[model samples]
Target: MAQLRSVPSRSGRGRTLLAATGLVLVAAFAQAPSTALAAGGPVPAAPAADGPQLSYVVNAVPGAVETRAVARAVRAAGGSVVVAYERIGVTVAHSGAPGFAEAMRAVPGVQSAGATRTAPLRASGTTDIGRPQKVDLKQALGQARQVERARGGTAAGGEPLEPLQWDISAIRADRAAKVDDGSRRVTVAVIDTGVDDTHPDLKANFSARQSASCVGGRADTSPGAWRPWDPASDYHGTHVAGTIAAARNGVGVAGVAPGVKVAALKVSEPGTSMFYAESVVCAFVFAADHGVAVTNNSYYVDPWLFNCRGDAGQRAILDAVGRAARYAERRGVVNVAAAGNSAMDLAAPKLKDTSSPDDSTPVSRTVDPATCWDVPTQLPGTVTVAATGAKGLRSYYSNYGLGRIDVAAPGGDSTQVPDLPAKNGNVLSTMPGGEYAYLAGTSMATPHVAGVVALLRSAHPGASPQEIQWLLKLEADNPGCPASDATCTGTRHVNSHYGYGLVDALDAVRR
Candidate 1:
């Protein structure tokens, strides 16, 4: 079965927590009007010293003077400043000190402070990471050969797997490429586990200059810093990159916007594959500073399935990431994130979140939709995406809501099979070690939209992020809510399952 987008319903302590859904990097966000802690409140209970050392982000007032003062306050509050991002006013710190977050928040110039994860730093790698189903190219190749014979024989010279890429045709990406394959100036950052630029399809268009490793909340621009930390299971970024811009070299599958370049932002924890606030914050700032046009976030911030507003710590995580995303948008970068794989209605009256504090024990709780949100995804100015199958229907595992999903695209489905040459329902793309695989999820669907967004960027280089997003929504081709399912609301043009509608790459270029 196709894996759902980030974080499959929280599993037992030792199972594969996030295969494709490790898009599970999801950061549950609560959309409250205010995240302010009680002013002049008494000190809260101290955290256990021996528990687990965690990373934290102390929001500062973005300036040299304010950041310096905040850094000193961090140390005084029993936290060590990891890196102070003056431009965005985010100071990353580490602390095992009891009441570190509460102490930091009390300091002047600190907007918010929260632990990045429930697990101790780097302790996440202890969990087993699962790999995706590999593509059966041998059988696929043989079948393509038979099709060639039916058309009079002996076809050659194309990505061997292109025959199975019904996804390209599904969104008219194939047709768009003929008119305009995209521009080399445009770059989309795959902010996920890590991207294998060494793959033949990706190397040609990989942008190393703008890539970095923000794993520990600090930006590391060392050589190949953007490459996967866990090659065994870090195939997610490479597959996603392939879908956005795998290059049309005819050696492998072509991407949605093949001429555009793709960059890597390795934010996943080395061993655990966890995505936390600090790393995510670093990615947005780095992308903004490095001139990234679009960022595809397939994962969510880990440790919490939903960061409720009532909780000061989760609120801080949401605030820090939201600041970074808005900053990137201000700097001309468009941010796109997955809508999650939980299959819950994000805009429902209330939600049952059972996977919170995922690094430790999970507790189930009912949350009001008016407050809790899917961070970065539900965060303001971020384009939230939903998954569709080969049949253009919402993927069974995709999360949806009347106002949550901004658009939909083929994320692939085992049951919604397409009738094209390739009979498989899963998405096909490049993998690490010069291989390819078939995976699915809103994680998979996100890149298809990112690719089209890149095309819009290439076509209208002078347009702002907001302008591009407007065009993206205006050009969508909505597939009305399923007749059998009453959950999908809104009109044919804008509905919960598809938002504005299925993305149209052809319109992105020609319109």
Candidate 2:
């Protein structure tokens, strides 16, 4: 999901390896104590029993009357407002009061309210910032030379320096780039860890004004704040950004939509490496307001693995995040999210989750798929994506569901049946510090779809979100189940494993 490094090893047969990182705690009230309407009137009375510092999301009816009433109730319930997304009627708050969640739910205008995590604020936990494995310089260079030679010494107009990125050719993005390298006016926001705008391939197409950091449930628009504080510790976002819009400047690697502008809306917390609901809501709202045409979300919202609507806490999270995503879609932004790395079928009758409340002790629980959701992938109005390997088969770690996934793209499988690239089956892209490395997961695949969306947007500047989505499905190459492949289910028109089939950039661009 958000952290691909936490995905289960291919050899583990779907058993996930938990990331060492813990969830972020609500350090303090996001705003100063004041009788301000936006800050939720005044701080409420402290609870009798002190408990772990917890964050809560309160969804209110979208309007001044309801918002003001909800804010007053939040303050009276001993919760301090972290940030209020007025557009979507979602407010994030933190409290140490034991019954704060229940108290907020009792508010007159509050739609839903619940604690965001099971861990205390500032809880003790280790950080697992995923690092890219160091590639041998000699081997990497040799591969590049070999690819160049095969292509007859660069295929015309400025090809990427690293020519062995088969993932680009797998989707025929290289051919699409030759025809139309997308339009710089169409911007795609990478709403993940953070992007390295300074990378030579990314710097030219980076959208500084549209980029921002939404780490603490609020948007920080300061220049360069959108980048990861520790680039090496968190390289996922940069890599994702590179795949979407790493400029075609004869540099590291070619992107799916190399001519488009890319914006970094950092939502992952640097310390804990967790992406909480508050930060995700903020990122969506920021992108919606900033004219972002598309957003690539490669991670699930933390600390819950599957937010069930039956539970008050999980319901509130789903409402807040879902509302934010819906708002973005209403504003002409097409949101794309990873279907997740767990191989479990999301459409199954029951599934066991052992990764919830990841900041603290996680317990294994059997959950009903209908109620519990892995959002915003499962959320309405968002495009859910599944992952395929180099051989055009489902990635071992990619999650699939009959009706859950909307499309499939190359995420790379190091253990594919017939590995195209012997050294690395994973997709290669520009890493932080002007380097390159291979990474695999649905996280890598989501950007390919987002980049294709960028191309569609560039070609049909007047197209609406619905029209673009229609084209995405219609233009894809429909490859039904491979003989004897258990992962493939449903009819040829639309199926669980491949969705509408592989996303075709060349076909999309030509259409």
Candidate 3:
């Protein structure tokens, strides 16, 4: 499952309650808009707390909730239960009662209860703090600043393009060597966290006219259904957008296609880490309905196959994605998605391996046997991207399969290319506020292809999305197999791990 949660520690009193309500509480946690509960199972109960605690998960049951009864029982036992959402679930700030556990356990309809998981108090072993090394704000701003100056002014009114501080020239050279910047203008839709239209690098590329925000529920602030910006997750969307198409001039890290127009859509709400399936679908629909040349999806949905074999919610969302992709195709738009960072082959048939990569043996990926359909990476009409390291080798974390992955690019690697400042490791772009930040994962790889698509569109304005996808795959470079593995998959030609080999910018443009 791709779900992320901040569970409370089970070592304390919470552990006692875990045996009864742990699984139920988790099942009732907040779900994406398109997510449906595992049918036929008992509705899950909300978690309990000892002190003033906040529950991120919200229950979905209609009318009155069980917590109210439990709270009443607790009061009899000299404790109080505070209903949070009131309709379906409640948040108990202080389980204010003597024998809190004993009282709650006796309540009717109460099956189980426990505290959530907790984060480590302090970092001791191997956990890196803050953002990864590659994100460099100064460099990104410097680059953006330079571009802005070159354009004769600052800010959007008459602002010069911001110059990034990173080595975008290297990336440009790498791609240009294979393809002349085919088209100066490319359009990509950012489908993750809502973007900050006011950020420096982002402002220049801000398609204020084409942007929309679904997170705020406004659907479209303008006649077209664009939402207003919410400040919670302020820099995330801008950071991602900057990485793709921040204007290039004298400053900041040059975008893969600096001149490309970005249709900014806020799918993830501000402050919230998780986005709803409905939000994703809405964004996809918006992009498909409009004429976005390419759409980049950097987020992944948590697997729900274990709970529901034929989840209507899951199918609804998948259907939306497929329809949107096909619709985009009709409009000559291409969809690019990130192969998740779980270090597994998304196309693999089942889950088997668990060991990390050994020095002598290649690393392996794990799949959920429970998944009934082809994983999202294998979905039709989308180009699933794999990440490669600085040495141009497949990234240890990149998901692969000749049939699934369509191409590869330099997304940076922490283990193999640790020498490059965290900001530069496998990194090749600008950050928010005109700074540069090194980021890895398929998130970084997807934009490269988006940029390539832009170049292809620029070179051949009339080209269809499928045609561009075909040309890139057709022109990719297959890294030769090692002498020892002559019988390996993709030994002589395109394989799953590397796809059609690495993307050659110059070659793609020339083609």
TM-score against truth, every candidate? 0.89, 0.91, 0.62
**Candidate of highest TM-score:** 2
Q: Rank the candidates by lDDT, best first.
A: 2, 1, 3
Write one digit per residue (lDDT tens) for candidate 3, span 1-511.
Answer: 1111000101100000001101111122122222222233222333443443211121222224454444445445443232222222322222323344444445566433322111101111111111334434455455555565665766432212223222233234334523453343567887655565555555666676556764421235354233223332233445456656766544444566666677677654333333333344446556655567777765443222111125433343344334445645676777776664545554556744332111112235443534433323445778877766666666656656546677776665555453222334455444444444555566667667677677677777887777888887877777854454322256446776667767666665565
Residue ranges of candidate 3 with Cα displaced over 4 Å:
1-130, 134-185, 216-218, 222-234, 302-309, 352-376, 418-423, 482-488
Q: What's the lDDT for all of these models?
A: 0.75, 0.76, 0.47
* Candidate closer to the true structure by lDDT (higher is better), 1 or 2: 2
- Can you write out model 2's per-residue Cα lDDT over 1-511, one digit (the tens) per residue? 2344222322111111223232354333333211134443444534533766677788888765676676677767776666676667887877778788888888877889887667654422223222345566567667677777765786775454446677788889989988898998999999877889999989999999999888868778788999986776567788888889888776677899999999999987665456778889888888888899999988777777788989888999999999999988998999988888778787889998886667667778889988998877888878888888878888888888788888999887778733223367777777778877777778788999999999999999988888998999998876887778776688888888988888999987887
| Ranking of predictions according to TM-score | 2, 1, 3
Candidate 1 off by > 4 Å? 1-51, 122-131, 147-158, 420-422
Please give the range of 10 consecutive residues that has the lowest summed lDDT in model 3.
9-18
Query: What's the residue-level lDDT of 149 in candidate 3?
Result: 62
lDDT of 1 at 328: 92
Alpha-carbon RMSD, each predicted model: 6.6, 3.5, 12.1
lDDT of 1 at 327: 88
Question: What's each prediction's clash count?
Answer: 17, 2, 69
